[model samples]
Target: MRVAVVVMETSHHRDTEGRRHIERLAATLNEAGHEVSVFCAQWWGGNASRFEPDEVTYRGVTVEPAETSFCTRLPALLAKYRPDVVHAFPTPSSVLRAANAGAKLARAPLVVEWFGDHEESVSARAIGTANQFVTPSELVQTELWEAGADSDLTTVIPESIDMDLVRDVVPAEEVDVVYAHPLDDSANIESLFLGLAELRQKGWSATVIGDGPERDTYERAAADLRIDDRVDFVGSCDRERRLAIYKGAQVFVQTAWREHFATELLWALACGCIAVVEYQAESSAHELVEHRDRAFRVTTPQEIADSIVASADMDRRTVDESLAEYDHAAVVEQYEALYERLVDEYGLF
Candidate 1:
């Protein structure tokens, strides 16, 4: 199938987890024997591979950037590269935008893919443009429903990670936890600091991976919490190095306030770290725990510390098995089938 993926920026632009997820999906679709193209936002700086004003090739696909939101530039994009099916990302905006873009450009089916609640508001124009809506997990699907979507509008899909980077590494006994994400708003780093302070009282050390605007917030929180000496925020890490960091840790922690499907959590699980997720009712982290027993969840500072302490006794092989369900190949097959079904049903080219 010739597919056009609509996304907002990528890791090629800035160090963002959402961007990385989009890149990973595009790469996977490319590997799954589809002729893929990406339409994304242009990152202003941060050393993205130099390309044309509007379109450029990054990784394997042709990535086109629209200057404004969907309203202005989409028609111009549709006039350029026509695709068979549309795979949209970054929640409601890109999905809505791509739906309009597809209407003008190609006679193709549209699948709206939401990474999280960032796309909470989908208008009639957006839904009218696409036939299929996919979310990373049931929790996200539920959110979509709550946001006035028609019943059964969303299908839950697991977010896949590159298992190659996660395999065969000796987890560092010295690193008790790995916090790999940009320390920012939705990440809820304050909760992490509070949890770590509690953990530190019991003699735990952690390595904070990734960088963002909120780094100083965490830096201060760590010190104010009196756990600064026990924490290390390593800037941005490459895939292998990040996985190596995960493999070396005894536990992997995510305190994000929101999540659709956390690829890094899957990486941590593949590496055999007991996954400690901060809980919220409308979160994929909770749904993932329901699907896999290897992960533990809690909301309060005490709950995290208790879960962390209890997780030290969990088996490694079991964690490895839990991560097996989310391998890219398995998830891609589901996507391909969905694509085929959508195309067949809608008579998309």
Candidate 2:
């Protein structure tokens, strides 16, 4: 089967969960004997408006930039590629419009991966144009249904992690808590700082991974809480380093106000860390560690601190076992089945 994955940017240009998801999907499809191509902007070289076309092979997937602009060049690109199915990531209204036009022009089924919330008006139009919808969690699917999308055409497919990256490292002799979240407003960094302050007496240090606009603000807050010395702001690091941090830490806390899938939470579980996630409206962290023994959902800073203290001596084997269903291989098989079903229904073969 020939598949065209449409996204605004690739991991080559930006490192985002959405781009990684698309790349992994493309790689998995290619490995499964399917022809896969990615249509995106040449964001890596900072040349999105280059007159000449930009093309490259990234992780065994062919990436072709939409040269003129996604809106203007996508239709022609789709016509040339002639894929059996067009898989588009939910980006912006303009891009989704282009993807819809391109899919229509190529006479291929359109599958839109809705990862985040969009304006209701824009979502209605995009959903109307898309043939199928794929969301990472039931919370997102519910949003699509409320936007007038056909429930039958929408499916919940959870985000997956590369289990091979889950290294078996012994926890460091020193007790440390790990919090891996982009220091963004949505991450609720304030709550985490407050929680860490509450646990100051426990003498357990913390390593806060990831970097963002709110880094300074959170750092200031940590100082105000008087836990600055105990918390280390390591900023962003490579995947290997992140896994090592998770493996060495006794607990992982997620204080995000809302998350569509909470990939980091899943990663912590896979790395054998005691996971504690703040319960939010759209959080899927509960899905990963349903049992209270493995993970806890907290609502306040006190609860967060308390959960960490309680989970300090817990075993990580059960939490790791719970993530088998979200392994990359299992996720790839689900996507393959979805693609085959869509292809047969649309008579694309």
User: Can you write out model 1's per-residue Cα lDDT over 94-157, one digit (the tens) per residue?
Assistant: 4466545654567667787765645256565565555777877777777767766665557877
Q: How many clashes does each candidate structure show, in the order listed?
A: 4, 0
lDDT of each: 0.68, 0.75
| Residue 230, candidate 1: alpha-carbon lDDT | 86
Candidate 2 least-lDDT 10 residues: 53-62
Best by TM-score: 2
- Return the TM-score for each candidate structure: 0.79, 0.84
Model 2: CA > 4 A from native: 8-16, 44-69, 92-98, 104-107, 117-123, 168-174, 316-319
Cα lDDT tens digits for candidate 2, 1-349: 8888887666666666666777777777776677777777655444343322223232111234443355787777787788889998776666777888888778788998877544324556766888898988887788878878899999988887777667444434344578877878787877777888888777778888989999998888889899999889999987777877787777888878777788888887887788788777767667666664667878888898888889876764423655777887888788878877887887854
